[model samples]
Every structure is written in structure tokens, then in C-alpha cells.
Target chain A: MKIGIIGGGAVGLLFAGYLGQKFDVTLIVRRELQLQSLLMNGITVHKGGSSFTTRVDSDLLTEVSMKFDFVIVAVKEYDLKPLEKVLELMDKNQPLLFLQNGIGHLEWVESLPHHNLLAGSVEHGALKENDHVLHHLGVGKTNLALIKGEWGAVEELVSQSIPSFPFLLKQDFEEMLLTKLFVNVLINPLTALTRVRNGKLVENPHLHQLQRDLFQELLLLYPHMERNVSFEGVVEICNNTYENRSSMLKDIESERKTEIESILGVLLEKAQREHHFVPIMNVVYRLVKGIEREGLGG
Target chain B: MKIGIIGGGAVGLLFAGYLGQKFDVTLIVRRELQLQSLLMNGITVHKGGSSFTTRVDSDLLTEVSMKFDFVIVAVKEYDLKPLEKVLELMDKNQPLLFLQNGIGHLEWVESLPHHNLLAGSVEHGALKENDHVLHHLGVGKTNLALIKGEWGAVEELVSQSIPSFPFLLKQDFEEMLLTKLFVNVLINPLTALTRVRNGKLVENPHLHQLQRDLFQELLLLYPHMERNVSFEGVVEICNNTYENRSSMLKDIESERKTEIESILGVLLEKAQREHHFVPIMNVVYRLVKGIEREGLGG
Candidate 1:
């Protein structure tokens, strides 16, 4: 099987490195520098106390022409607009999987003409060190759900799971995405705003109170989230990734754009549509956006 | 007239520098280092292109034993608890004026045994560079209101105003403090939380929206605040202090204790008492406190 990972980010490199060991993989990136470096060094993933180098075919996103059995979209949600044209030109029959963080891309992905569209909730924590190097901080599985068409591609990926990185099939796409969204909504912005490690959300009483208030505000929008995601489960995730800086925090610290629009932005819009008063969510959303503006030379 | 000023902070040094020129002044400080520095070199005031040094007697807060016609309490709101005992031992006839921010100190000042009590709202933007050096950033006046007892002392100080350091008397103490409180509540926490300068509160639309939401929440507690403080006035203050960092922002950056409790904490108590919903205020309050803990070696 041939796999095409459509980003050189942490998740993209992780997938390309592990999957390349088992199948023919191509790592596609937008930057010429990253593409040149990837062509020279391939992908190196450091997990636990061991490290391995995987030799994978690499190409620039605009220059890539070869077809793949399965293509995984690993770019951020904010970066998806430019790829729309690229995705449109792809083989309509090819199976495409989106591995973005938030459900902000669901509508866009559903609009694509691909026959088999998969939405994934990635639980692993991966950090990109440089162009072709990544740290696989957390070893976890990817939960995939069929957004449309046949589920054969997702099932095949699930059956061919690697040792540490497993793939599980989820029954409902919205529930699967919301489960991860719940954790992201609670953890990401708070860590980013406070510039603290993940565990501080639960460790600090004041932050914990703020987190609960935010959780309550989110529950007003998705009343069924309580059944899908427990409050304690969110706390457990913070404890599990105690020392790790969240992706949003990392982005803010590095002066990179964050997924605030995808995570909190989506919720703010939903609240407005439903006439739900999510003031805390609104405050957090605007704060993160304001900070992003400040970080980006505003 | 002999005037004893308590606190060696920006406001304290500012008062000592200007008022020391006309009256016999004694600058009181809690730290021996600041006292020694002030004793060695008088208070230095740098305003625009000119600089002036005013020599004044210095004494530690614990060692001060001299009598004064009036005393100015220039400490932060959170630092007032430790001074309660010292205040009780003062001469009953000596009028005490508090130059603290927020209305949190009003009730506590009322409980003092002094014959005359005055509360002041400092409009000047002063930054302390060292133990005895201060940059007089903004040349605004100090608004003084009589909290209790006779108005003779306040009248004397108002009549003997120093050049460029004017003193205006306000009829209502609550109204005077609330006006400053309104600006502090809106500008301080937002600037500190976002780590932006005062100007960004108005420059950044997202933060401006958050500020407006917070202003609306505050109105629920004090319906008459609209008359005392205009939303336009708050924006104008941000514009006037465009390049200045708020004191609370500086406090957080220095890892020093913040006055969040005195400012937002008091308002939170009032909201609870009246059953008002100030979700944004609550979130901002908790986030600042949480960040304070993180900064203070939590």
C-alpha cells in the first residue's frame, strides 16, 4: 500500500516515519527548505529511549504528481484553504483521511469529491524538532471514522497497525471528534493563555475552577458531551501529559498561529447560532485571538 | 508642615519627590535597602528632558517614631493588612490619607481610629527605576476625597499645590475611587493577562471587545457607574497611556504579588452578594490569580 502524508509537521512526520517502515510512503510539504531537508535525511523519530530513521519518498506539495493508495491530510485547519485546489485535483476515487485537531475542517472535508473520506482523532503527542526530526512524546492510537463512502481503507489501516501507534475504528464521526474536541477545548487555550504546562490546569485550584467554568459553558452547547466526555477524563488527560506543553501553547510560544479559530472559534459560532450564553468561552476565544495578534507583530 | 509618606514604591517616591520640595517630608519604607538608598541620595524625579532631586528624611516603617501633621499611605491594597497595627499606634490627631488603587481599601480605612481620613486616586504615571530614582511618565493630578473627619488638612494640601503636581479635591470619596477603579478594572487585568501595553487594549479589537464585555458586567453591580465613568473615557485613557505598561502588568512580569485580590477579588465578592453574573470578570480574576501562583514558584 502507498501512503501520502500531506504535511511535514510533527504529526505528518510521525505518520510518514512509522508507516514508511511498513508501506511505500511519500512525505509532502509546502516549504522547499523542508522538502530539500526531507529528501536528504528522510524522517527521524525519537520515541522513549530509542530512535530510528525511516527512508521515505519526499516531494513538494505543489510538485507532487504520483498517486497514492491512501492520502492523509495532516496540515493545520488554518492551512487547509490553499490545499483545497490541490485536493480538488487529486484522483476522485482515492481515499483521503483528515488528521487535523478540531472539527472545524469537517464541513470543508465533507465537501470534497473523494469517494472515501475519513476523519481521525489523533491521541498521540508528537513534537517536531526541526525539518526532518520529530519527538514522539506520547505513544497512542488514532481513532478513525468514515465520514462518507466505503470504510475499506480505514479498516485496512486499522488492521495493519504498527507496534506502538495503533489505529482504531470509531462508529460515529461527530462523537469521535467531539470527544477529542472536548479535551482540546479545555486544555489548549487555557495552557496557551497561561503559558503553563498541561498539568497546571488541574494542579492549580484557580485554573481548575476556570476550567470547570469553561467546561460548564461548553456543556451548554453540547449537552450530550457529558455522556461522551466526563470532566474527570479531561483532568486525567492533563495529569497524563503533566509536563508537556500543549500544541497551542507551543504555537503561541514560538509566535506561530494557533488553532484557536478552529477549536474555540467553532464553539463561539455555535453558541451564537443557538442563542446560548457562553461568555467564558467568548472571553477565552477573544483573548487567544488577541494574544495571537500581539504575537504576530500587531 | 511636616508630611510623612509611607511606601517607597513608585507612588511613594513620586509623592516624596514633589511634596518634599514645599514641606518637611519623611519617606518611610519597609525595606532597609530602599531607606539607606533614599538617605544616601534624595528622591530623583526625571520628567521629560529635566531632572530634579529633592532631599528628605528617610526612616524604616518599623523604626519611624516622629510625629507629622499628615501621613500619606502609598502602599498597594494587598500590603495594607500588615500596616494595621502600625496605623493603630499613630497619633489620633494625625490625618491619614490613603493613595491606594481600587475601592477595596475604603472599608478598611474607615475602621482606623484617626481623626481625619482621606482617600486619593493618583492619576500620575510614575515608574520607579531604583530605590531613589523615578521617572515621572505622566504629569496628571491626584484627586483627593475626604473619607472621614474634618477637611482642614485636605484643604491645606490643596491650597499649597506644587507646580505640575496639582491636587484637586473631590466631594465624594466613593465616586472618586470608583472612577479610578473603573479604569483599573478594565485596563489592568487585560493588559497583564495578554502581556500587552495599555494601548493594545484599545488598539486590538478583540481585547477591546473583552474590555467592553467586562465594563458591561461591572455596570450590573454599579448601575450609576455609567455616570461616573464613560466607556469612551476608558478608551481615551488607553490612548493617552499608549506606550505605558500597567502596574499590574509590571507586577506579573517581575513575579511580584499582584493586587488582583483587592481589585477583582472585591468585585467578585460584591457580584456574589447581589447574585450578579460576571462570568468574564470571574474568569479574568481566576486566570490572573493562577498566573500569579505560577509566577510565584507554584
Candidate 2:
């Protein structure tokens, strides 16, 4: 099976390397430097204290006049808007998995067929450069689900001969999504706003309570969040990736629009739906919104 | 009735000058220049576009041997503890009014009769040196409360006055104290930790959001609060005093231990009462407690 990965950066390249272990993978990168480097020297991945190079089909979307079995969108929140052309280029029957931080954004995939609608959750970090060198910093895990019906191929892929980033099936994907939403709301926007690393969240006085408050309050919105995700698990993840900068932090550093709205922003909306109160999150919303409006994000 | 004011700083001198407007007031100010200048040239008070001078008792605390009806402790919070010997000069029956921010600690006042527990909440800005200058910038209204009730001459003295500098009996004193408590929790530690000004809170993304989140969470803690002070009233005070530097800002500027403990440190204390559940205050409490241990106050 030929899988077309749309995002050129870390996640895209990592997935390409993973799936390329068996399947023929082609990566769609944007920049000329990446396309040139990957096409010339294949793609090099630095993971597990070693470096491996694999020659995958590396080309720009304009260079490709073909279809694939699946197309994964791994771009940043705002960058996904430009991926419309990639989706249009996908085979009508091919599945599309969106790997993102927050949820309530299925409308963007509305143009695609319902049978092909697949949502996935990824918990990992990877760094990439224009040279197509990928640095797998921490854990790698992906849980995919068919949003509508029982798609057997997805589960078969989950039990594949080669695992793509330790891929697995998420039972009742919405709950996992909600669990992720809670974590991101507590982690991403916070680190992004505070400019602190994941582990350092425990150290910062201005933020630690906020994390605790955010998690406690979001639990009111998603009552089963704690039941699914343990605090030790979250804190361990935070500490293990302490040195790694969160995507939101990088976005703020690069002067990009924050996914705060999609993350904590949507939580407040869900609070209204769940008849739960999120006073702290509302404060977080007003603040990040003000920061966004101050136009500080370039 | 003889009244002595310690700490020739702005607040002290202002208290001396304002009280001198009616009854006998002697400001126990230090330094030859401050004393000579205040007694020589007098205090220049700029109020409502009109400037005036007042000649009052401007001398050192050591020189004050006579018993006074009232003693106003107008020193800075840091200087308050060291002034224990000076506060000892007070007459046993003398009511001591404290006109400073943060809590007026009572370890020293423990010996005094309960009626001697005097707390004053004033909104006044005064800058003084060789120039005895007190600028009642916008308003100088003071709210004083007797936590320990003893009929004093100053109460009648203030009430019978021309209603100038509007002094009111803070009916429910604890609310006023909590109003100031919220200020400490919301403004002081935040500005101290961030090392920014009131206006800057609206600018910096991370610092700004932390303030709002912590502030709103505090208000959400209103039910948990022993006092239900008006948030709007505090905001108005903050807006009015936006340009005015707070005690915490001043402490940070001078490099001192923020009274974050005196303000929010108590939140960690196990509930003494059955009706207490200060979950929101715990956020500020833990943050400050951590910073305190890390010795960042220096």
C-alpha cells in the first residue's frame, strides 16, 4: 500500500520512516530545501540512540499526479487550511487521519466521504529541519478510529506487520480525544504562554496551580478524564519530556496563531454543554484571547 | 488629644498632615534634613490642584517620651516588625492605627487590649523627602475599622471632622481586609514574581494571563473566602491605582521578601472552620510557598 503523508515536518517524516519499514511511503513536503535534501539523500531519522536513512518517494504536491491508499495531515493548526488541495488529491475511497491536539473540528473534513473519516490521537514529539533530518525526542504512540462505521482495515492496519509510531486502536475514540483535550488544555497553552518546558510546569509558581486548577475544572466537563488518564502518567510524560518545547510554545516563539481556542477554548464551550462551570478556563480563555488580539503573534 | 506618627515616609507624613488639619499631630520623622525641612519649610500637599504646607511635630521616635492618645503605624510592611520597640512607646490605652498594605501582624499587639487592634485602609499617594509633599492624587478617603472595639477620641475626631479626606468606619472590617488580601494575592505576588508594573500586566502574554486566571479563580474562591468583598470595587481601585506602584512592586524594586506569605500563605493552613474550602486560593498559596522556599524573593 502506498501512503501519502501531507505534512513535511517531524510527524510527517517520522510516520514516513515508520510506515516505510514495510510499505512504500511518499512524503509531501512544502519547501524546496526539504524536497531537494530528501530526494537527494533520502530521509535520515535519529531515534533510539542511532541514525537510519531510508529512501522514500519525496516530492512536492505539484510533482505528484497520483493517488494513494491513505493521506495523513500532520501540519500545524492553521497550516491545515492549505492541506485542502492534498485532500482533494486523495483517492475518494482512501482514509484520512488527522493528527492534532484538540477536537471539535470535524467540519474541516466535511468535503470528504464519511466512510473515509478517521480521527487519530498521537502522543509524541519530533524535531525536523529543512534537511529532512528527524529527531524523535520522546515517546511515540498513535491511536486511530473510524469516526462513523466499523472499518476493518483500520484495525488490520493497527495489527500491521510494521507499527507506525506504536499505533493502536482507541476504544471509544471520543473519550480519548476528550482526555487529550484535557491534557492539552492544561499543558500546551500553559507551556506556550509561560515559555516553560513540560517538566518545569511543576516548578513555576504562577503555573503549577493553574495546571492543577485547569485539570480539576476540566474534569467537571469530562468526568471520566481522570479515570482514563492518571496524574502520574501525565506528570511522568511531562517530566520525561521536560526539555522538549511544546508545539504551542514553538508557535508562540514563531509568532503563530495559538491553538488555545481549539484546546481550552472549546473546553469552555463544552462546559456550557455539560452544565459544568469552568471559571478558571474562562479566565485562561480571556487572557489568551487578549494575547492573540494584542496581535503579538505576528 | 496628642497623636504621634512614625516613619516620616509619604504615608506617615500624609497621615500627620491630614490629621494635623484638625487635632494636635506630631510626625516622628527621622533625619535632620527631613525634620529640619518639614519643620522649616513644612509639608507641601498638592490636592485638587491646590498646594499647601503644614507645620507639625517632625522628630525622631526616640524623642517622643510623652504618651499620646493615638499612634499611627505608617511604616512599610518590612519595616513594621523592626518597629516593635517603637510601637512599644505607645500608651497601653492608645489606639494604634495601621495605614499600610498587607496584614497588620498582631504578635506585637497581642499584649495590648483587644480595642487597640486598629486597621486603616486608605487610598492615598504621597511622595516625601526633604520636601514634605503629600499628593492626594485622586482621593484620600480612608476606611478604618476597630477589630477590637474600644471607644476612642480619634473615632469621634474623624467623624466630626469636615468630611475631608472622607474617613468611614469600615463596618465589616474583615471584608476590607480580604479586599486587601485579594490585592496581595492578585497584584503583589504576581507583579513581584513577574517583576512588572500594573500597566505591563496588560502587555506581557504569560504574566497577563496568569494574573487574570489567578484573579478570577480567587473570586471564584469568594464562596470559600471568609469575606465577600466586591470584585468590581477592587478592580476600580486597581484601575485608579494602575499608575501607582503597589507595596509588592516597591518591595521587588527594593529587593525584599514579598509578603505573599502573609497574604496568601495562610491558604495552605488546614481548615480551621467547617465552612471553609479555599480551593482557588490554594493555587496562589502553593505557587508562593514554592517560590518562598526557592529563595527567589531576593
Candidate 3:
């Protein structure tokens, strides 16, 4: 099976490196420098105190010449706009998987004519050191669910999964995505606003109070989330990933755009539709949005 | 006339320097170091491109012996509890003036048996350089209103006002304190949490939106406040004091305890009492409280 990933970010590079071992993989990057470097040096994967090099095909997103068995849409939600034409031209029968955070892309993905669409939540922590190298910081399973198609359509993807980088199947697409969304919503903006690691939210009493208040608001807004997961489970994630810096904080530190719109922005929209009052979320949403605007310029 | 000012903070030192010129002023200080410095060099008042020195008696709060015509409680709301014994020692016949920020001290002040009590909202910006020196950043008027007793008892306080530090008498005590509380609530926590100056809230669109949302919630929570001030009025203050660093932000930077409890804490209490939902204020209150805990330890 041949796989084509349409991003050169940490997640894209990570998937390429791991999947290149069993099947042919091509990384479609935006920058020429990243593409050239990847073509020259292949890709490096650093995991579990061990490093390995994997050879994979590389191409610019616009210059992809061959069709693949599966195409993983691994870019950020913000970068999805430019890939509209590319996605439209792709083989409609081939399965397309989205690995972006937040539920912002659900509506957009539903509109696409692709017959087999999959939504994935990447649980593993991966950070790109450079254009051609990535460090798999944490080993975790990727949860994949069918958004609008049969899971059997991507059976090749399930077969390619190794123990080190496993892909677990989820039955309900909404439940899986919403479960992930709940964690991201509570964790991402708070860490970005506070500039603290995940653990501090649970470590500090006042912050824990704040986390609980925010969680209460989230539960009130979306009670269905409560049936899927508990607040303690979320706190457990904070404990487990205590030292890790959230990607939102990294985005702010690097002056890059954050995924706040997809995460918090989506929740705010739902709150508005239901005419629910969510003061805590509103304040955080505006604050993170304000910080993002200042960081990214307008 | 003899005036005793409690607390050696910026507001306390400011009152001491200004009132010492007209009245025999004795500043009640907390630390021996501050008392020694004030005794050795008097108090320096820096304002409007000029500086001057004024001599005022300084003593430890425990050593305050002489009865005064008026006593100004210029300490923070948090520090007021420790002064319970001292407040009991104060002459109940003489008017006592409280010059703390926020509405947290309202109920406590009312509970005091002092027959003549006045609440002051200090508008002037004063930054203490050291124990005995202060720089008056702005020449704003101080608003005074009777909290529990007759205003005529504290007439000497109004009479001693100088040109640079004028005291403007306000008719409605609730109106005056609530007005100040409104400004503090809007500016203090936002600047402190975002670590921006007062002006950035208005200069940044998203922050300004958050400010407006918070202001709307305030108006809803306390409709009486709406009759006293408008949202545009608050924005105008933000514009006027654009370069000003909120005391809370300064407190955070200095690793000192913030006035979060007095400002945001008081507002949250009111929201709880009125059964009003204030999400933004709740989050900011908790976050600032969390930061304060971390800064001060436990």
C-alpha cells in the first residue's frame, strides 16, 4: 500500500517515518527547503532513546505525480483552506484521513465528495526538530473513526500499524472526536494563557479550581461529553502529561498561529447557538484569540 | 489637625506625604525597616517634574499611642484583618477613613463600631520607590464618600487637600466605590493575566472585545453601576491611562501578593450573591488567584 501525507509538520513527518517502514510513503510539504532537505536526507525518527532513518518519497503539495492507496490530511486546520483544490482533484474513491485537532473541520470534511473519509486523533506526542527530523516524544495509540464511510475502506492503514505506533479503531466518530475535543479544550487554552505545563493545572489548587470551573462550564454546555468521559479522566491526562508543553503554548512562543479557533472558537459557536451563557469560556476564548492576534499579527 | 495613616504602601505613603504638609501626620508602618527609613529621611514626593520632602512621624502599628482627629486606613484589603486589634484601639469618636481598592472592605468597614467612617477611592497613581519615597505618576482626584457616618466629621480631611492631590467629595458612597470597583475590575485582572499595560486592552481588538464582554457582564450583574457609568466611559479611562501598569501586574512582576482578592474576589462574591453568571470574571479571578498563590507560595 502506498500512502501520501499532505503536510511536513511534526505529525506528518512522524507518520511518514513510521509508515515508510511497511509501505511506500510520500510527504507533501509546502516549503521547497523542507521538501529538498527531506529528499536529500530522507527522514529521521527519534524514539525511545533510539534513532533510525527511513527513506520516503517527497514532493511539493502542488507537484504530486502519483495516486496513493490512502492520503492523510495531516496539516493544521488553518492550512486546510489552501488544500481545497488539491483535495478536489484527488481520487474520490481513495480513503482520505484527517489528523488535525479539534472538531472545526467536521462540517468541511462532510461537504467534500470523498466516499471514504476518516477522522483521526493523534494521541502520540511528536515534535519536529528540523525540516527532515522528528522526535516521537511519547508512545501512544492513534484513534481513528469513520466520519462518513466504512472502516473497511482503510483496512490497509490498520494492517500497517505496529505496536510502537498503534492505530486503534473507534466505533463512534462523534464520541471519539468529542472526547478528544474535551481534553484539548480544557488543556490547550489554559496552558497557553497561563504559560504553564499541563501538570500545573492539577498541581496548583487555584488552577485546579479554575480547571474545574472551566470543566463545569464545558459539561453544562455539552452534557453528552460527560457520558463519554469524566472530569477525573481529564485530570489524569494532565497528570500523565505533566511536563509536556501544550502545542498551543508552543505556537504562542514561536509566534505562530494557534488552533484556538478550531478548539475554543467551535465551542463558543455552539454556546451561541444554544443561547447558553459561558462566561469562563468566553473570557478564555477572547484572551487566547487576543494573544494569537498579537502573536501572528492581525 | 493630627492625621494618622495606617499602612506604608503606595496609597499609605501617598496620603502621608500629601497630608503631612497641612496636618500633623503620623504614618503607621508594618516593618521596622520602613519605619527606620521614614524616620531618617522623612518622605519624598515626586510629582509633575518636581520633587519635595515632607516630614511625618513614623511608628510601628503596635507603638501608635497618640489619639488623632482622623485615621486613614490606607492598607490593602488583605492586610486589614491583621489590623483588627489596632482598629479596635482606634478612637471611635474620631472619623476613620479607609483608602483600600475594591469593594471587599465594604461589609467589614460597616461592621466596625467606629461612628464616623469614610471610604476613599484613590485615583492618583503612586509608585513607591523605596520605603520612604514615592513617585506620583498621575495627578488624579481622590473621591471620598461616607460609608457609615456623617461626612462632616471628616471635614478636616477634605480641607487638607493640596493642589497636586485634591480630594473631591462624592455624594453617594456606593456610587463612588462601585465606580472605582468597575474600573479596577475591568483593568486590573486583564492586564495582570495578559501581562499587558492598561492601554493594550483597548489597543488590541480581541482584548478590547473581552473587555467589552466583561463590562457587559458587569452591567448585567450590577444594573445600578450602569446608571453611574457607561462602557465608553471605561474605555476612555483605558485610553487615558494607556501607559499605566495596573497595580496587580506590578504586584505579579515583583513577586508580591496581588490585590486580586479585593478586586476580582469581591466582584465574584457579588456575582455569587446575586446569582448572576459571570464566566469571564470567574476564570480571570481563578487564574490571577492561581498566579498569586504560585508567586507567594501556598
Best by TM-score: 1
Measured with C-alpha atoms, the lDDT of residue B98 in candidate 3 is 87
Candidate 3 per-residue lDDT, tens place, A19-118, comes to 9988889999989999989999999999878999999999998889649888999999988988989999988888899998888888999999989999
Evaluate fnat for each of the predicted models and list the values in order: 0.78, 0.08, 0.72
lDDT: worst 10-residue window of model 2 chain B: B266-275
lDDT tens string, model 1, A92-137?
Answer: 8888899988888899889888898999999999999999999999
Residue range with the least summed lDDT across 10 consecutive positions in model 1 chain A:
A152-161
Winner by lDDT? 1
TM-score against truth, every candidate:
0.98, 0.65, 0.91
Evaluated at residue B155, the lDDT of candidate 2 is 77
lDDT digits (tens) for residues A1-298 of candidate 2? 7777877877888888777777778888788778888888887888778988888897786677557776677766557777677567656677777876677575676556535767788887887754678887776688786676555446555777464367877767677677677667777866654556787776665567667777778777767676887666667777778788887778666665778877876677778887886666765565456555444531
Cα lDDT of model 3 by residue, B54-171, tens digit:
9999999988884988888998888898888888887788788888887877888899888988989888999999999999997798898988778754676677668777888898
Candidate 3's clash total is 3
Chain A TM-score compared with the true chain A, each model in order: 0.98, 0.86, 0.97
Per-residue lDDT for B114-158 in model 1, tens only? 889999999999999999999999789999998989876657788
Interface RMSD of 3: 1.7
Clashing residue pairs, backbone N/CA/C < 3 A, model 3 = A279-B279, A279-B280, A280-B279
